[model samples]
Target chain A: AQTIHQWPVAEIKAVGSPLSLGCTIKGKSSPNLYWYWQATGGTLQQLFYSITVGQVESVVQLNLSASRPKDDQFILSTEKLLLSHSGFYLCAWTTNSDYTFGSGTRLLVI
Target chain B: AQSVTQPDARVTVSEGASLQLRCKYSSSVTPYLFWYVQYPRQGLQLLLKYYSGDPVVQGVNGFEAEFSKSNSSFHLRKASVHWSDSAVYFCAVSYRGSALGRLHFGAGTQLIVIP
Candidate 1:
């Protein structure tokens, strides 16, 4: 069975602080990875997606970037945080039909 | 561009009652449709999917959704609601054939099951 793991279940950061979120997928290789964000009461927005290692595509520009350094690793990061950046971040991977999502990371920016 | 719309922002139902959540989509081609459930502070879980063939698809927890090509709608239904069914439900659409294609999501409908 495949499993996804995300780091730092939750975080609270001040504005202007740097942030990084990581996801690792096991039992699958060369899977399509995606990053999604959702505000407290807003729709889920696709942030970025990667089909292979070292290549990523931006779906929506939220001033954030993603890197797929390895076959099973995906990272989302930003140099500085903004008040609007606070939300729930989700990591997902898809091979064919449906996507499998990780537990997710909750971020709060003050 | 492909898009999904979940009309009801919130819905309340008594436990053991029949329930339905509406969804609509706009796309140039026959797109893939899905319904996902998100527990509080958790990731979205696939409830059901519609690709081809049958218009009605069954999913986990006795949930099912029927696809209507003429109406451009895919609505989720459950025979009996439970208190544990309370959660936010999302409707999504994917146009591309490959897995790399991104899914467009709806604003989501919050389901509240009352005892």
Candidate 2:
């Protein structure tokens, strides 16, 4: 069985502070990773995706960047957080038609 | 460009009643269709997916959806509803061969089952 683990399930941060969210996939090797964001009552938006290590594609620019440092690890970070950046961030990986998502990280920027 | 539309933003149904959530899509070619359910404070879980063959596909929890190329729609249905079936349902679409292509999601329908 494959599992995706995301860190810091919930976070409360001051505006302009740096933020970093991490996700690690276990039992899957070289799987395609993706990042998605959803507002409190908005639709899910694809942020970024990576097919292999060290290469990532930006789908929607939200002042954020993603990196696949290792085959099993993907990181989403920003030098400074904005008030609008606060939302639910999800990490997912797909080997075929279906995608498996992480538990998600709820961010609140105060 | 591929996009999905879930008409009903919210739906309320009584337990044991039949349920149907409508979904439509816009694509140049046959797209990969998927239905996902998101429980509160949880990640999206795949309920079912359609690529080819059998227009009607069965999914987990007795949920099923029918794909219609003529209507460009894939509507989810359940013969009987349960209180536990309440959640946000999303309709997504992607190109056939581009598994890595980002999935275009609908705004989602919030289903509230009355017990």
Candidate 3:
């Protein structure tokens, strides 16, 4: 069984502030990692995905960037936050036969 | 681009009653479809999935879904509903062979079970 961990359950950021959200996976080998954003009343959209270490592809960029620094560690970051950057951010990983998601971080940018 | 649609934003059902929630999807190939449940203020949990073979798949908690290729739909059904079954259910699809097998999720339908 694999587990995904995400930190800072909720966040409130001001405009132009830096942001970082982290996710770590357990019990997997070279798994595919993903980042998803769920905006208010909006569907879940794939933000990024990484197949291996040090490689990530952005599906939809909303001034946000993702990095897979290690095999089990994936991070979502932003240099500056905009009001539109607020939403529920989810970190997920896929094993050969299953998919699992972290608790998610809810960001509210004022 | 693969997409999924969960038509019912909200559905209310009585406990011990059978329940069904509709989900429609768009994909070029036979996409990997999934059903996930989200409790209030909680992250999403995978309830079941469909890869290939059987059109009808059984899932956790007495829940099952049938894939209708002609209808492009995967509707979840439960024999008996419980109050704990109330949650937001999301339908998702993913490309099978892509390196980036990203799961495209639906807007999600909130199911409310009344006792």
Give the 10-residue window scoring lowest on summed lDDT in candidate 3 chain A.
A92-101
- Model 3 error, position A56 (Å): 1.2
Q: How big is the positional error of residue A15 in model 3, measured in Å on the Cα after superposition?
A: 1.7
Write one digit per residue (lDDT tens) for candidate 3, span A17-41: 9999999998998989999999966
User: Looking at model 1, how many pairs of residues clash?
Assistant: 0
Model 2 chain A lDDT-worst window of ten: A92-101
Error of 1 at B15 (Å): 0.7
Task: Show model 1 residue runs off by greater than 4 Å.
Answer: none
Q: What CA root-mean-square deviation does each model show from the true structure?
A: 1.0, 1.0, 1.3
lDDT of 1 by residue, A10-108 (tens): 999999999999999999979999999998889999899999999999989988999999999999999999999999999999978679999999999
Query: Model 3, A84: alpha-carbon shift in Å?
Result: 1.6
Residue-wise C-alpha lDDT for candidate 2, range A1-110, written one tens digit per residue = 99999988999999999999999999999999999999987789999999999999998999999999999999999999999998899999998767899999999999
Q: Compose the digit string of candidate 3's lDDT tens values, residues B1-115.
A: 6678888899999999999999999876888889999887788898899999999999999999999999999999999999999999999888777667778889999999999
The segments of candidate 3 whose C-alpha lies over 4 angstroms from its true place after superposition are none
Better of 2 and 3 by TM-score: 2
Model 1 lDDT per residue over B64-84, tens place: 999999999999999999999
DockQ values per model: 0.81, 0.81, 0.78
Against the reference, the lDDT scores of all candidates come to 0.93, 0.94, 0.90
Give native contacts recovered, as a fraction, per prediction. Answer: 0.75, 0.79, 0.82
What's the TM-score of chain B for every model shown? 0.95, 0.96, 0.96
Instruction: Compose the digit string of candidate 2's lDDT tens values, residues B62-89.
Output: 9999999999999999999999999999
- Residue B33, model 2, lDDT: 92
